[model samples]
Target: MSENRKKNSALKVILIIILVVGLAVAWIGYRAFIASSIATSEEYFYVHTDEPYESVIKRIEDEGIVKNPSYFNYVARAMDLQTGIKPGRYKLSKDLSNRRFIGNLRGGYQEAVPFRFQNLRLKENFAGALGKNFEADSTTFLNLLNNEALAEKYGFNKDNFFLMFIPNTYEIYWNTKPEEIIDRFSKEYAKFWNADRKAKAAALNMTPEEVSVLASIVKGEALHVDEMPEIAGLYINRLKRGMLLQADPTVIFANNDFTIRRVLNRHLTIDNPYNTYRYKGLPPGPIMMPSIASIDAVLNYNQHEYIYMCAKDDFSGYHNFAKTVAEHQVNARKFQQALDARNIKK
Candidate 1:
């Protein structure tokens, strides 16, 4: 009887051990299955850091990027990723298992916003626009560019730090540091000024910054590329002959109005140093953001002795190049007549 009782106790202990082992295996298998399912889904997810984290997670869940907030929280905690999530724009697969999705978000590899330079008017304006998109301070951007030491380190001379930038679209990692962005742009601008361009600028007795400054002026003067060279020649000739460029754009820029149909003598009397009609030589810096065509025109300006020019008065986007003051006045009169005929005041 004692042996039978002992045998029964041993069997019962064994059974209990097997049952516990089986339950443990099942739980492990279930956890593994959940993790695997989360990793291979096709769900989409996005995060915009403009809002609070809770709101961001809510949006992520609403967009079906994650299966459940609790699952995301659990995975995030388990992987020690709770502190690694970066704030910015992010995109993820909606069908991604909670584990994979949370891991990716924590890794900060989900998305990057693109920075583009379309419809950029001025350096400050472009900086302001970029600030709006990237949550950067525009004042900081402008200050960095205007920093004399920084500008010089980036190959910009004292005379033309304001116009050293070359406008183009750029892809920046989201939430990029402001100083880093400026430094990157400065490096890219240096790259654009290749050895060949540098030599060409040297041959013209100009620095790259000066060339860009003149290019900006040419950019503001004409919208047509075919006329850039002639306009460039005109300005070059004026510089050589010690004549005031007498450019209307400079006067308009000084007055902060390019909409006037005509430039008056009083407009030329504006006390700003940018008024080429009053100030000899080019303005202190570029008045506008020049296109690549204008920059090239400055590098490849035609060798001409022409000192003056006026619009052809045909609205054909052409110019009448002049060699003397008298000829310039005649062309100006013709342009004025054309403007009068069109009832365009300038």
Candidate 2:
């Protein structure tokens, strides 16, 4: 009976050893396989639209975020992440476990990218800027902007479609669609035209579009914000008197050649309706996307009698204003002599 008891005690010791070994192995496996799988230096990972699971894995691997790609693959399969892939920009941090990483992606938890633009000159440029931030391609964006049916839905046409996009920062997802961007901008445009602004437009006898058009001209003419109201007043005076605007910026725009620094008589003769020297009213559309300051400058223009302006001879980016032709001629001669001295023939 004593010998039998000794053998049973020996078996108990062996069983305890096996149990301890099993627990240790299990702990090590859990740490290696499930925990600390992500080892990235970056703060975020971007998964693009229509990206396959393999491409996602490749991107993670290329970014050197996953410590073991095969193990990560196994974990991903076990979690069934392949069947539930969501595209977006995901934030990352060091020491992220495989389970948490997959969970964030599967849950569609993403960060919104901030989008901003100002002083963009053309629709193509605006399209390109939007494409860079969102999932839509530039060609697709341009197509939507030019679509008459779509533009009409937003109360715009191909010529004035760009007016909807005010220069401001917007918080949006990286994968947002082109139509979605347009919709947001359309709402923003409506919000900008409040009752106070509409009343101001009415007081000026101008539509919002016409105000934007004149603002574009004001933007092109002035380099100083302090002078914008004065310039706007000068244009308004000309319009009130039924006089030709004779804005050199319009002539440059008519030629579609922004390189022309000197607005020669030949440039003024451009047959396009954008030429203020030849046309009687505001252009059919804005020549460039004007700033809010420029727009407000037109709305609350300074009450002035000046009808003519000449660029300062010192090239200070400020203009000389005149209430009569004689004063304008004096300013003009000063500028002309300065231009001649510099030999600016163009």
Best by TM-score: 2
**Residue 86, model 1, lDDT:** 61
lDDT of 2: 0.87
TM-score of 2: 0.89
lDDT string for model 2 (194-214, tens) is 888889999999988889889
* Model 1 C-alpha lDDT per residue in residues 157-239, reported as the tens digit of each score: 54466665677777886577787887777788778889999999998888777787788888877868888988898898888
> Where in model 1 is the C-alpha error above 4 Å?
1-80, 92-100, 146-149, 152-159
User: Which regions of candidate 2 fall more than 4 Å away from where they truly are?
Assistant: 1-43
Local distance difference test values of all predictions, in order = 0.73, 0.87
TM-score of each: 0.77, 0.89
